[model samples]
Target: MRLKGKVALVAGAGTGIGAATARRFVAEGASVVLTGRRPGPLAEVAADLGEAALAVPADMADTAQAREAVRAGVERFGSLDVVIANAGGHGGNAVADTDDEDWRLSIESNLTTCFVTCREALPALVESKGAIVVVSSIAGLTAGPAVAGYVTTKHALVGLTRSIARDYGPRGVRVNCLCPGWVRTPMADEQMDELVERDGITRDEAYALVTKDVPLRRPATAEEIAAICLFLASPESAIMTGSVIVADGGATAVDLPTLAFA
Candidate 1:
């Protein structure tokens, strides 16, 4: 096991990519502390993971709560070898409709949460010479319509990841980010619903429209994304740091001219 004796802290571990990563990490031999805003889901995942996981419910958007979660993880595991800042979502609002609350929520949910968690866990990570994986999005690399706040936050995460990598690489703490394109998660499903309603298209049509630019013609599964996270957290990627691993079904790689036009 690449992570056999390591301790990991995973934010947003209740569901989606975070849950999958936590499960994968535990299976590969790491003690993980799972944190999420909801207690029931987090506790369920922790219970399912048996003694290898600890559920610590905390609202990661709050700086104090984020710090407390990290502290709880260290206390439970005695050391921290990996930190996965995976808590983020689309607090939906178009730029024209987005008020201060929408903008603040997006920042707190996606950007500030990562900063708070990383800031609190940096000391322990440095001590263990650990790795940090920030879950960003392809939206971080390119602009998306109608998601100004989310796009901005995700883009900021990439910069934040690079900053940490540059500052900590020599210090033995590796920092990197995963820039996933559209993945088949609950959030994606919800976004699809919104798209269907907004554009008055069938669900399948909406899916096809979204995947039209992707070379693979489909979104990634949650498991696929989790596998990449496992590799980044594992020793196999020891030499990899400060990189944005794009798992977007080739969405970010294709030229517009290559796509077949109807």
Candidate 2:
């Protein structure tokens, strides 16, 4: 077990990558504290992980709630050794179409949550010389169509990762950011459903259309993303910090000008 005696706080552990990471962490012998806005999903995941997991329902974007989640984790586990800041959401249209509400929501979910989680967990992490894996999106490095708020907040996350790593490195906390292109999570299924409705296509076809030019020609699975998180959180990545690791199935490697030739 790579994380045999570690304790991890998974900020958005209710579903998708967060849930997968929680399960993986437990498998690696880590005690995980699960937090999210949804109580039901958090409880379900905690139940599945048995005693190795604790469920704490909280809106991580809120400072008070975020602090409480961290406190609860440390109270139960005695120490916090890792953090998976995976709480985020998709929102907004193009800049011209995005309203204040949409922009605010996107910032709160995608940016504030990570910031608050890390802020609250920093002391514990420093104490344990722990690592943090910030779950960003490929959108952080490159823009996608008509998602101004998502693009902006994701880009901001990269900067946040670097800043935290730089500031905390001396304190023995390693921080890294993960940018996945498209993962087949419930959130992404929602986006695919939109394409299905607009193009009269099946959900599978919708996903295919989006990833047709990607070298892998398919979206990633949550479990696949979780594996990367595991590495970042474990001793395997002890020497790494302030790194932006892209796991996009080669989507960002292609030149749009050369796609037509393919």
The sequence of per-residue lDDT tens digits that candidate 2 reaches over residues 158-196 is 999999999999999999999999899998999999999
The lDDT values for all models are 0.89, 0.94
For candidate 2, the 10 contiguous residues with the lowest summed lDDT are 87-96
Quickly count the clashes in candidate 1: 0
* TM-scores for every candidate against the unseen true structure: 0.93, 0.98
The numbered model that scores best in lDDT is 2
Going through the candidates in the order shown, the clash numbers are: 0, 0
Q: Which stretches of model 1 miss by more than 4 angstroms? A: 195-206, 257-262
lDDT of 1 by residue, 67-166 (tens): 8888888888899999999998865667898999999989999999999889888999999999999999998898887889999999999999999999
Q: What local lDDT score does residue 66 receive in model 1, on the 0 to 100 scale?
A: 77
lDDT of 1: 0.89
